[model samples]
Target: MIELNPLVELIIMNFAVGLIVTISLNIEVGYLRIPQFGRLLAVIVGAVIAAAVPGRILALYLGLPYGAEYADHMYNAKIVIQINNFLSKNLLLSLAVFILTLVLAALAGGVIGYLCAYPALRLKGSYLGITLLTFGEIVTSIAWNYQPLVGGTAGVYMVNPFAFVGSGSSSLAALITLTIAISIYIYAEILARSPFVRMLKAIRDSEVASEVYGKNIVKARAQTLVIGGAIAAVAGALWATYTGRMNVASYTRLTWTFWPWAFMMLGGVGNNLGILVGVLLFTLARTAIIQYKYVITSVIPIAAEWLEYILVGLVIIFVVMFKPQGLMPEKPTLTLPRKAIEEIRKRVEQEQGRL
Candidate 1:
């Protein structure tokens, strides 16, 4: 059997993560028309939870103290070692803990998202975007400076849930991440086909019109935010667990916010199929650049680190200039039943004849 290269595995892992982040953004910006510029907020919340929650749970499960004692690096390291040793001997317990962490992380994210909706109710467009962006920056700064949050700049090491898989842990993680990504894509596709999606599009197109038709625009937006935020948080949690570390620095605006937005735009904002294509294209290009930075720099006479940004900017510019709607523009959704649509069409023709 041919063994998979670690670099290939890492690329696949990143692509899966990108898919999750972009799809969540699609729900907020594409379907609901909520320009959530601070998409990092929900993602960081997940990472923070992953950093703190699972360790505390493990401490309690192992009959250890869960508070300040666990916060100490020395003490925490000892406990982590013990837990690893125990998990190494018991695969079932390790898997259970991993699954439980994901569930708790998702719930925590949902709660934060629900609270965020209150502010969203009063804000719109750029104002809403700026407000959320500021909030994300503030929280990230706190996480960075505050030692209690993921050990500040130093960060905290996390136990690998798939350690039970031994030497194949990286491959297992890649497989799991891809599975979850596919599941999220399917769910988003289903949402796109639903009447609720039509309602979202209606609200996106014109809040006044939706409200005039008796739709609660604020409520709808809140609900959409809650759902999208929860999903984004899950992506963050997965990243934290997969990497076996939690650090505020890892959840930067560039990684959690800007890139996902870029993917959404390049892929054609609301189109799921476009999202997949866009993610693959951008991710492959990014990985290739990173892998061949020396050759690129020698050829281009520019810093390799800056080239990725330049490429992203160029793609965005070209897409906007030539295909403003995206490579695959948003298509009109048919929500009403076929018979109902036919009846409405016939009525419209009769009214036109009388006119």
Candidate 2:
């Protein structure tokens, strides 16, 4: 029986983490009218802080505040007791540090989101895209040399990847992670269905008009940005812990952030299910290419490494030219019928703000 090696399996596992973080951020930035690209920093920052904190070990021991039962089932182990035994000395302090790190990451994301509010005042679409891309690059570069901040290019280390201990089966972990990732997508779908997020689309379509109708654009934008930032940070912590590494080199420009944008765009901006399909499809494509590199090169006389960006760029071009709505257009819940569409049309006509 031909089976993939553990290393290959682990890489695939981590890719699942990347997909979740990327898609979660897409919900906020791509769909929710808050174009935030500096969020890649939140993930790394979360990972670094989570790794260095001793309390993560403690959280395992003391157990999560209320999710102990579910954690036990999900982990299929007594994680708290295991973690407690491992970090026997000063377990409370260690747990405290871990929890504190989570809070800090959340707050950091919110603050950065708030910072971008000013720039987002008159920005949307391409103008916002350029600013966000620059922010992502600048923050990523800081991760490169800001050694004192994130342990420099070497990054941080020895982070726990799971909410519990002994939960590292590559296949099972990937499946579980994928399920949670889908859950987040489901939540994003709910947000999209709600009128609250409709206001966001309004802002995306026309900020001036949304404000003209008494919507607090700044608050709405800031709320979305902060929510997206925090979600990305949670993913970051997961990524760091999964690898047991936290060096800038580990989470730099090459891997963490850019690909999510590609996945999000390819999937369809403002579409949750599309994001999932995009992540799954793109990941499968990348894996297939890597797995068949020898045959691919033999047939085409090309290097796999050199073709990385080239392939991705070509894929993006294809997305722009065709399937512009992505594999799944932002779906309408329960599939709106023609009558419902006409009703919506009338409502929109009656009061564009109402619909």
Candidate 3:
């Protein structure tokens, strides 16, 4: 087996997770124009579900302690080792556990999205954005203080389905995550070219006009949120699985929400390909700074920790001032068949020539 450089592995994992989350954000805020500031809500929902749910199911199957006891640090550590041993030997079971966790996470995330739609329907513009942001912060507070959900501040071990791969588990996990992220990117591209996305773009431009055209604005917004939420949750689940732990505190507004928005904005709002470009550039920049922060700080006057924030802020400001539309600005999707549009264009040109 070819060994991956540790740095390369880390970058790949970050890119995959960032891509998934940013694409989710693009679907809502970009195509649907849903000011989805509370993106972290569904992500936390996914991570919490991945953290708390799967192990219990496995415990029931194996006749081990679960629920409250499973949340205990000592019990969690001991039991997870046992589970990992079992999973490492039985590849099928490990795969099952992995799939089951993501499925549950996606479902719960979708439900949460549906619930958020109430506030979405009631509020608009910055008010709606603030409401969503508050919702995320509220969820974070609950998860941070609630022990049973994910062992609270202490955190909890996640069932590593990839443990079956032994020492190569990290590489396998990164590969799986990157594959899933790419799959979602392709799906998002197809979705962008779909009539549904066109409708979303219309509603985004003018809800009143969309409503006049018989689009159910409420239903559309709700559906968009549900889809975005489920996708984001999958990203969260993947992160939990990759790290083999559920640290609710790590799933913060800065990493999960704001970063994705910045990525989507920098990449180009409403452009999936542009999102890929943005995520790649931002992920590399962020990762490099983190990896060499101490080294860089030793030579510079700035604090190592704050360098990321300062650099990102400066970069965003530059982009906004010069490339306000993003590195790849949104382009109009073809609403008509290419051949038909060409024929019409030819007729119009001929008529103009006669005139």
Candidate 4:
């Protein structure tokens, strides 16, 4: 068996995570035309749940600390080590625990998105976006201060359910993540072709007209956010699992929200395959810049740490100026096949002639 290159693995892993989140964003912003500026909220909530929940459950199962003591970094590290040891020997239990963790995280994220629907129904445009952004910031602050929720600023270690794979654990984890991402991409494609999405598009293109046609505009938007949040949370859970740690500070708006938006815009809004392409290209660029920042900075006399941000800003400008429709623009969708529509039209005309 050929070993995967570490650099390639890193890019693939990041691209997978990016694809998951970007697709979620595309569903909201591109398909539903929702101003979901708080995309990071679901991700952070999911990561926190993934980081804190499963370990506590395992601790309870093993007669260990699952409460306040478990939140302490010292206790967290020790307990997680014990959990990993146990998981390394029990493949069935490990798999069960991993699935449970993701389910719980997705639920938490979905709940948050559902709650945001209240505000979403009332606000529109930039106001809604700002409100969403504020919600994310508030959650970050709470997570940072609430020690019981993943050890506050110190963060908490996660139980590695893939520990049973031993030396190939990380590789297996990356493969699993990528697999999930691809599965989500398939789901998104199916959703895009569904009648529900067509309804959403009608509302997106014109809320008043959609309402005039008996569509519940508010309900569709709410549904979009809930679905988007759940999907984004899956990405966050995967990240937490891959890193085996959850730091509240790590989930920033710029990283989780804005970057995904950029990816969606660059790829072509509402285009799922385009999201894959955009995510792969951008993830490669980001990883390469991070890897060779020192070399670039040495030659250019710029701050290495700021290079990625500079690249994002430049890319956004370029996309807006020259490629507003993106690399793969959104294609028109039809409710019926042309042949079916023609048949219906002929039937209607024949009925009219008989009348």
Error of 2 at 127 (Å): 4.1
Candidate 4, which segments miss by more than 4 Å at Cα?
1-3, 340-355
Q: Give per-residue CA lDDT, model 1, range 1-355, as digits (tens).
A: 2335988988888999999989999998999877788889989888888778877788788898677666556676777777667776778887887777777777877777787788788887889889888888998999888876567777777767777656777688787888999999999999999888889999988889999999988788878888888889889888888887787887888889888988888989999989988898899999999999999999989878899999998988888788877777888875689899999999999999999
Clashing pairs in 2: 54-94, 55-94, 55-95, 60-80, 61-80, 147-152, 154-247, 155-246, 155-247, 156-246
Model 2 regions lying over 4 Å from their true place = 1-15, 32-35, 54-104, 122-127, 161-176, 331-355
RMSD of each: 5.3, 8.7, 4.9, 3.5
Per model, how many backbone clashes are there? Answer: 0, 10, 0, 0
Clashing pairs in 4: none
What are the models' TM-scores? 0.91, 0.73, 0.93, 0.93
The lDDT for every candidate, in the order shown, is: 0.84, 0.63, 0.90, 0.90
- Flag regions of model 1 displaced more than 4 Å: 1-3, 335-355
Please report the TM-score between candidate 1 and the true structure: 0.91
Model 2: lDDT of residue 113: 67
- Report the C-alpha lDDT of model 2 over 223-266, residue by residue, as the tens digit: 88777777677677655545555666666544666778778778
Which residue pairs does candidate 3 place in steric collision?
A: none
Error of 3 at 165 (Å): 1.1
Q: What residue pairs clash in candidate 1, if any at all?
A: none
Q: Give the TM-score of candidate 4.
A: 0.93
- State the local distance difference test value for candidate 2: 0.63
Candidate 3 residue lDDT tens string, 1-355: 3457889889999999999999999999998778898999999999999989988888878889988889888789988888888888998988988999889989988998899889989988999999999999999999999887788988899888988667888888999899999999999999999888899999988989999999998898889999999999999999998898888878889989988888888999889999999999988998888898888988997877788898778767887789878999999975689899999999999999999
Q: For residues 1-355, could you state the per-residue lDDT of candidate 4 as single tens digits?
A: 2346778778878999999999999999988777889999999988988988899989999999999899898788999999899999999999999899889988888898899899988988999999999999999999999998789989999889999978778778888899999999999999999999989988888889989999987788778888999999989999989987888888999999999988988899899988889998899889888899889988999877688898888888999999987889999895688899999999999999999
